[model samples]
Target chain A: MQESNARVGAPDWLEEIRWNADGLVPAIAQDAVTGDILMMAWMNAESLRLTAEEGQAVYWSRSRGKLWRKGETSGHQQVISEIRLDCDEDVILLKVEQKGGIACHTGRRSCFYRRLEGGQWASVDPVLRNPEAIYGKKQGGSNHE
Target chain B: MQESNARVGAPDWLEEIRWNADGLVPAIAQDAVTGDILMMAWMNAESLRLTAEEGQAVYWSRSRGKLWRKGETSGHQQVISEIRLDCDEDVILLKVEQKGGIACHTGRRSCFYRRLEGGQWASVDPVLRNPEAIYGKKQGGSNHE
Candidate 1:
């Protein structure tokens, strides 16, 4: 959508978003230093508010139906350096300082590790560390929702 | 979610994704050259498959409930150079060559032009072009769904 440089005068910034029927908006986490997109997840108003207040990444876990604080489980927390809202206001961008240098639960630098090559998805990035070491044995399964 | 370097052997690559209840997944578009995240949009299986086959971005508009071909209206089409799926098989990333050097309907180079500053969102980027000229006066409204 075409927009002028928006002057957001709303007292309640979270209310300005065009949230979906589920009261959620897509949030993308990008490395503040490298500009590498770490991951994408959903956030409700509560999670969005918490992220701003806490200066950390907090997302709504659709599957768990609760707030998913980044790095809470794996100790890989994302320290929020800046937050951005798209021109459309349906998407949020978190410029973060990824604490562990690993944003993917798969134990990689970023979640986007599989690139489509020759009509097939290939692992273009190596596993930086073992998943078992990151999530522990029982919770080692990757679930980035 | 922790995962191995996924070996996507499924005949139907689309089936591997964990689509939301609305059968939509979020797709991120990044500038292949600069790694600047241009925008984020939703895609159903149909749009995702079309993107792969057509080598361009085709998203599903939740507001309009139809397929949206990038640049169809604005001549700012995204020529995708690479597509990456997240480790959890939930999110899709498009590394693209953004046409006209503009990815935002706001006439900016990227949709993420607003930055959080002192609890307020401020427009930090300049509008590179005029939206009315890109989308015509009648279609000048920005809608990046």
Candidate 2:
């Protein structure tokens, strides 16, 4: 199956990713144009492959031990423009055009909404929408976290 | 000691970070001014504390099972300007001034220097210095991967 994927235009470079002991690599999603980091998630080999093939963000949910397509429940899918690997091949970066202008489970543009200020973490960014409105009552919690 | 730190104005928010089952959290280092993500590393409680106290990047070396002070070897220290936690508290973001203008041990401005292109991982950025020059004969390989 892996060989068939490579034959079907899947890049062999995926095999070069140096996954950690747990078979996971840290993947960061960044706004393609603004460079604002949207979020970070773990990606296993299968998730990375599917993400590349699907041109969307797919992450490995360690807590659930399953594949998770970003914004699957929130309708804020990330449209990947480019994928990058760190020099050490352990980290992945996705340049994405975020749909719905929301990326955080909190319904914020980015998960990184709080900033450290005066020895305190202050929520400096506004919540774009209440998460309850986005995910409904099933807004149990974030799988990526 | 922990109490003394709190008395000295250390915010208790650090304790709120939701580490993974492995007691590690993903931390992304971004160029404070440019907003370019320089690298990603893991941090444990101790490393996170030390980084906050020292105003530099400190990481937990999963492979070595020891704390690593960034730039301790390559003189490419990440002087942190601010540290932010994601809403979910599972990730950290550091706004840093990358010392020496190099963040990657491979002598690149950022560890994320390679981009996916034409079914291959292409090195799209220039190396500012050779790894040999940065770490001498001990350019032993990146601890990141």
Which candidate number would show the highest lDDT if scored against the true structure? 2
Residue B145's lDDT within candidate 2 is 34
DockQ of each: 0.59, 0.72
Error of 1 at B127 (Å): 0.6
Docking class for model 2 is medium
Q: How well does each candidate reproduce the native contacts, as fnat?
A: 0.79, 0.85
Candidate 2's displacement at residue B55, Å, is: 1.2
lDDT of 2 at B122: 95
Candidate 1 ranges beyond 4 A from true positions: A1-11, B1-11
Worst 10 residues of 2 chain A by lDDT: A1-10
What are the per-residue Cα lDDT tens digits for candidate 2 across A51-140?
888999998887787888998988889999999999888899999999999999888999898887766789999999988899887768
Q: Of the candidates shown, which would achieve the greatest DockQ relative to the real structure? A: 2
